[model samples]
Target chain A: MNYNLPVLLIAIPILFSFLSLILGSFNKILSKIILISVIIFNIISGICIYNSVLKNGNILTVIGNYLPPFGINLISTYTSISFLILLYIVFLVASLIFVSKNDDRADKISSVLLLYLASSTGILLTGDIFNLFVFIEIFSISNIILISIKDKKLSIKGSLKYLIITSIGASLYLFGIGFLYGILGTLNLSEISLNFDNISYFSKVFIFLFFLGSIMAELEVFPFNFWISDSYAGSKNYVNILLSGLSSIVALYIFIRLFLTVFGYPTFISFSYSLPFNVKTLFLTIFGLSVIVNELAALSSKNVKRILGFSSASSLSLILLSLSTGLKNGVMAAMLIAISVIISKPLLFLSSHQIMKGKGEKNLNSFIDGFRRNPLFSILFIIGVFTLVGFPLTPSFWGKFLLFISATEKISYTTLILVIVVFSITIELFYYFRLMHKLFIKDENIKVEKTKNNFVYIFSGILLASIIIFFSVKPYFTQNIVEKTTEDIFDKSGYIKSCLKSGEIDDR
Target chain B: MMIDNRTLYIYSFIIFLIGIYGAITNRNLIKILVSLSIIETALNIFLVSTGYINGSNPPILHSGMKLISPNSINISDPLPHALVLTAIVIGVGTTAIGIGLTIKLYNHYKTLNVNRMGDKDEL
Candidate 1:
């Protein structure tokens, strides 16, 4: 069987992660070198793979010499490849953040970071339902370990919470897969959808619960959102950056795949045609309320991490709102918002952490006196806040603009209502700006205390913020490619042709 | 005789709910970990049992049993078995790591419970 570019893209990371384990991924320099080399190699490979996919339309790669739905196929439609490429950037930036002049654990943490990238990238590209489960488990395992590398108490507590809580969520997904498999007799999502015109009510129930549970954990929504706040509040700032920014985006990507490709549940993906009052209205109502409440939570938060946590929730709501659109515009908007959050959140995390001492908890007030003395930091923080708040000219502003406009075209009243409810939460900005006002007002009084002026830390934060802005203007920088990736979402024949063909697959 | 598939599913759901309750309410980290294991077990059982038919043998083929036709053995589905084995490995890894962390946490915090570990600001 020929290798599918997308499957290979997914395989490259997992393959390296496994090898790193054999060669000691977490404790040595040799392993760290291997790990980084492998990721860089894959990133290069992903670039080429993405190019080929764009030119050829789509490609499929089957594992174990078997055919589709049986052999565990990996389909590289545009979206997964786009995410794979985006993930490489996120992980690369994160690596720069972790490496430092005085970082003793740099070797070990970089190794784990590579594994995180592999698992997350795998999540984006895998087509088999069971394979997706394996990727999710890998992601949870690697990330829990990564969080533990922070502070002793923080690591232990956060890791345990992450491990146990996410394992429960993963179990739900496994149960759902079992239910789906028993009835449909297949583990491939594409095949399952093709085989059954409509699933039984029982299967529907399983699908709804399983997908919701898993995505809920990753997205940090209402039910499972409990774990992430403590994590963000407790873990080192850099770790929180990885969790809030990159991890959640990958999870959202997986959610979109499941929502649109597998379940095809119109409840989430918005359609252009008139949806029935109860059908469309109910879902939007709940999603809209989530956006409002999450914004309010972000506003009310006292701790910096908790504030970012709530901000992430708001971003999650926006992406969910975009996905609920179900139209072409919705898919594009989802990717844009996801890219925005993942890129900007890291900038905020690393910058805040660099400013504050490695304290157990991070509060907005923690950085008081910074605005007046450190205009550099002040500018970065303001830019970070601006991006988070979706101020004009930021990545999120454009991202949310696309989503709001797409949403309004179909359901103007719904969009207006959500926008108003969300705007009301700007009072929360008082909490953040108050910190800024304090820093600026007290600028000269406080001294820059004992701190590590590491080049990597400062450089990483600046680099992260710069990338955020760069993408904002020329979002077409990656947007051109990512949006191109979304176009292949409905191209099922491209998957089937490559899967069924031996050498000359019709990659139309 | 018809098997009660519906009853099997109800039983599975009940087990899952109990596991969730135990996980949420339990105080000890090990006990919470055990509850998580229960949840994993319940999910695995649901997956494996879903692969079962009224009358079927394990999917493995004995050397002497290849005499006649391919379809007549009433072979249980092998896919869930493969999937479950992976799940089991994953579950063991998570539990092992959790227990190790709990032990470390106990040594550090002087308590196996979450409440005492907090406010230490030790991280």
Candidate 2:
């Protein structure tokens, strides 16, 4: 039998999410087993899809026998496959942590986790615009449930805010889709891209704004990110991992895909026939402002989780800054920064669960005597901090180095943006160092609790840190992968041609 | 104004703005949810309106329909109808989740006013 990797990648998890729920009522352990096996199967299939794409170009799997432009299809490229693999790895590590802990709500959490994975994977693989919206809704709903798993007042409020704001954003996006379908009469992404040039300038700008405004909430940008700090602080560590690792990456991917491919650079339109505003410049300005705002928020926040949330938001804004450049080098730099952030942020979040063992408070004071309790975790936390701050010998350092180099190569208004970027980094370093100093300070009044070092925390933290180290030591390997993914992202004509071809084999 | 395509769009836009106004200005949680539903319904109407033609028939080919020449008959676009169905379903799910959370919040805070639900100081 022919194996269809893309369909199986999505279908397996969705199938198991329900199965796990049913099995959970009977036996929770059996549900956990089912969840793990499905994840492992997804990982293996993701690798197979990646290898196949590398060997035989892009793979397109139509849902039914209908041809492209008529049937919904799943297209897997190098960049998407890389994201898929990263998502699987992160989910696997997180699941291990979940299993090692004993909670009364384990069965419910496991099922929601599976659905989250499935929806995110669907977002990554779908080739139609409407399908993307559907998956995004599923992703948001599951995320709301995940955040409110504890049923605390704080979690409930956070989830409520998230639900209301995101629902509004999704409706705005659906409105934009209605406008697009009315004008182009097609929902397929490739078909839309093909006809995008024919749209009037006013309509183009309106559609772009609508889409940008909607996605900004998910990407955790300036205006729509008011609830981020609360959500991050209220949720559990594992849920934070899912938020920072999987959800953020998927949202960023969608942003990049929509901007870089669908309403792409206006090559066919004349340069002089500009819209009322320059979208590229507008994006850069927004991202630049977001970077400064996030850093300042992080500096003033007393809660550690809120600080981390702001830092993650700042990192996302910086990546968006690079992407706004609309050049190949800029795309590569964005990918590099994205990878480093994805790897290091989760490590910091996971290790914090161990580092802040007995601290009932999430403020900076909790870290006053942290080093005395867990020296190893403190060290790992410091390392993760250094990586985020772009110190030498870390993946973030190389990523930032390339970003600055690319920014300088442009030699335009980006110089001012670069200055803003550097100044924000300085602001970030100030609080990070303060936290570090707090960690190492010796205080006799502080009672150091002997926190048990669980295998799950140490294993996942060490695994992620080691991976970061491997990438830092071998920058060339990271560079090569980023370059290939960048190339794949920018090849719009190739994507359109490959997706629109008729009568392709099912590869099932 | 007579009811026309332009009129439908105008009315939907007005309703959408009203919803947004209510969502921003209202202090009650249930009112905000109702406003959100209003916005959703307005968008659904707008989407379905996009597929409507002045003189077109429903996009169904009956058994007695002949394979006429191209452009012989005007038929409304069915894609947006299908899309609106999906959007309505999603809207219902979102509303249910919103109401569920509102109930829980009311139970905890003893008030439906968003401003009365103070910031959570304790986790």
Candidate 3:
């Protein structure tokens, strides 16, 4: 593979999204075919990029013939490539369900999903600050369209709220970008990082605050996450995968990528200057509150989607808390938890979607006699919830284990965070088991129609389940990659050098 | 007299604050969207002003201009101008979507006031 593969990974999906829309106008099946093909093509390219990065150290593809500092560039490092692979895999499974299900606007949905794929690819790969902003705008706009596609009152309401909140977030981010550009006179992330220390301390604080406001909304952290439950409750199941599974992971990736690389302290990156405050402690406090509050919220909620929404939020906070430990092990733990969430949340959403069919209400009671109706779905649901609650064989268990081990190492807030974590886990276990219990509860005197499982649903379920089981059986497989990714994230000099080393990769 | 960069920054900041105040105080969805647009415009103004250089020409080279060294080309930075263009397009797209959602909500609820919508459920 050539160095152009990084850009191709972004361009192909965008090209295909438009193609699918134009073609799907003629025939609906064409859009489905295009979505699958585009995703498959992306997966192949993602693997190639991964291999190329592993072999060639890092691949930088400069756009528009401009050198790295002046032009747009895509950097495919170990960290980004790994996340890209995981994202495409999730997209593939979600597309399987998306393709199988029929909707009046299937063509539009296909195109939007394709655009989402492109925007996410851009988010992962781009090295330019302004380019990142543009892709984020596209990502959120497409997200708004997807959430309200159902056209129901609740969905519209949720989408409207999401629109308002995200618009504000995006605007704040723009203001931040304006400030940065005004001070730094360059839009390139590496160049900015190189000159970050020259700026005044107050400017640094204000810029970082702007970035925090925006990322907090996108990251769906506690205070800025009011849009999530309502939006998740109102969106379609696969879109839930897009929101909780895809977007949250991407947002967290953004949080890590930007914060660690651009604004990281000297302890993390030798050249980067330390921030005025302790970011780790701050994140811990905020994320700890998010964990406890979200889990309690989940425990109280009865709507299945809202419960799952709260659960996903709690898992995201748990991942963030692990990240806040600011240790390699903490990142590894975060990866473990993130992987578990990316796998299990989709499984839960898809299975619950199948189980909730023909039921007027979306609640835990909808799962009564669920096993009798759709045995495969119920079993999958059990495994998913079990994985979430940190069953011993699951990756979440390993994640929580690693988190506690790291948390014990000489942090001032150790016991406090541990207590909060323990309390959160206890609540999680209670509620998830309560949900699983409802799956097997016998409903008397009701002759329930046996719900037929679509082959596509079963295929996707098995595919997702085997991923969880594979990691469960062998946790070390992903641990190595996560370790390398953590190293890649910390290697700020290497990132800057690769992006700034002009035309060497191009000759190849 | 040509406005200095500090004056431009302060003005834009005030405009941004006004937008934020409007967004926070407004109960109507359309009003909120308009506030968002105002915020976008303020940011764009701030961004474009960041590229400003007093008495400098627009970052353009026409045939009538005498050939000069690269350092001698007295022009404002063009990058933020380009950035503002992109931001404007994005702002337009976001506003369009916001309006579409507002229309849908109004058709469903027969009211535009956010508080008039149904109360939040326990879920």
Listed in order, each prediction's TM-score against the native is: 0.88, 0.96, 0.96
Model 3, span A31-102: residue lDDT tens? 999999989999988898888888989888888778878889888889888888889988898899889988
lDDT, candidate 3, B1-123, per-residue tens? 999888998999899899999999999889899999999989988999998988899878898777678678888998888889999999999999999899888988899999898835523
RMSD of 2: 2.2
- lDDT for position A26 in model 3: 93
Candidate 1 Cα errors over 4 Å, as ranges = A1-27, A101-108, A265-286, A357-361, A410-421, A424-428, A447-452, A475-482, A490-508, B1-6, B63-70, B115-117, B120-123
Put down candidate 1 lDDT per residue, A221-322, tens digits, no spaces.
665566655667666655777787777667777766665556553333344212123324544555566667676777766777777767777677667766
Better model by lDDT: candidate 1 vs candidate 2: 2
DockQ of each: 0.65, 0.77, 0.67
- In order of the candidates, what TM-score does chain B achieve? 0.82, 0.90, 0.92
Residue A303, candidate 2: Cα error in Å is: 0.9
Better of 1 and 2 by TM-score: 2
**Ranking of models by DockQ:** 2, 3, 1
Candidate 3 lDDT: 0.85
Output the TM-score of candidate 3.
0.96
DockQ score, prediction 1: 0.65
Clashing pairs in 3: none
Docking class of 3: medium
Off by over 4 Å in 2: A1-3, A266-276, A502-508, B1-3
